[model samples]
Target: MMRFAVLGSGSGGNAAVVECGGLRLMIDAGLSAKQLSARLQSVGIDPKSLDGILLTHEHGDHVRGLKVFLKQNPIPVYTTPATARVVRETGIDGGTWKFFEAGQAFTLGGISVETFAIQHDAVDPVGFVLGDQSRRLGFLSDAGFVTRSMTERLRGLAGLFVEANYDEGLLEADTKRPWSIKQRISSRHGHLSNTQVTELIREISHPALGRVVLGHLSSDCNTPDIILNRLRACLGELGHGHVGLHCAGQHEPSDWFDF
Candidate 1:
């Protein structure tokens, strides 16, 4: 059996826990150490019990809490060499480093993890497809665009935790961010728009896909209602309305999902 939960997700921070075969792994430590521990316990997960941390990139919203968190619960931190070097330079040098080349498969506590490069502005960003004997889950967040290879790797998963960062119409209509920032966000190396992610879901949807939790939403530009309505409709059109659709938030954790 495999289970997971998104502790919180948004522009402020992003974090999640995945457990299988009696081993627990944290996907990121973007929240403050205090909050991370509290939230973990809130979900019945003891902070110190994590087997390791899998890092996607070195962006602040994805790694700010890592330094303090590891100080309290030291464990192996896995990532690409470039990502590790960039994160270490930022003074988050507490945990033991474990390196994996992109597009390779590695094993952690009997779980097989397939890593693929992601198109994001951060250095050496990546996504993962983790699987055991009977289940697989894909984690793909903070990506600008989807690739053919990514879709191929993520197909037929039991669950997916992906980013639906912004809506094109809302982003263009918002005046808070400067034009430059907007351009960057919609660029090939920033974050995925709602349309982009929805298309990704369309391509990867299969009989075995049981759940999808949307993460890393733009606070100013995206809302749960909008994305959920869009995704729910898309899933219905694909004859996948039975698939569970969830949204993770910045201030609280999502319900645990088991597969």
Candidate 2:
């Protein structure tokens, strides 16, 4: 069986630890090494045992503390060529880096992982589909639009983590943010709104879909209740209200789910 947990999930920072078989893997290290260690300890995982860090993009919120964190433990970092160029330019340590295509399948820590392109501002951004021999989990975030490619690649998962970043009504009414900021969030490379998320959920909902986690929310444009109630209402209407829904918190991690 494989287990996963969110160390923290949001634009403030993000990280997830996945344990499968005898391997321990990290999805991203948006937090500092110290913070990452503490978060891992909170879930009873030792930072020293991390085998790798799989990067989704080169955004600061996703790679800020990477250098310091890899300094001591030196886990292999996997990313695309475009992301590696920026990581090098940033003077991040290269000793633990490896390069891979953003839309190919690969192995890390003895488990299989597949990467698929997602719409984002970075040179090459992606969402991940990871699994062991028995089960699969999909992680999709930071994408502005969900392409047909996304729906096809993310099918048939035991666990799913996707962004439900904002409410359309909230985003439209918030004049406090500049026009450009709002436009970007509403753009093709921006985040997904609550409706887009549930819409995508309907497209991907299958019998094998076991757990769903909503993550990478905008602190200004969304609240847990707003997103939750919307999903609950939709799922209840669809007669699948019993599905487990987890809302990621900005200040703390969420509980681990086993599959």
Q: Which candidate has the top score in lDDT?
A: 1
Per-model TM against the reference: 0.98, 0.96
Q: Which stretches of model 1 miss by more than 4 angstroms?
A: none
Q: When superposed on Cα atoms, how far off is each prediction in RMSD?
A: 0.8, 1.2
Q: After best superposition, candidate 2 residue 173: deviation in angstroms? A: 1.3
Per-residue lDDT tens digits of candidate 1, residues 235-258?
Answer: 899998988989898999998999
TM-score of 2: 0.96
Model 2 agreement with the true structure over 123-149: per-residue lDDT tens digits: 899888888878998999788999998
Residue 37, candidate 2: Cα error in Å is 1.2
Shift of residue 180 alpha carbon in model 2, Å: 0.6
Candidate 2 regions with alpha-carbon error over 4 angstroms: none
Error of 2 at 168 (Å): 0.8
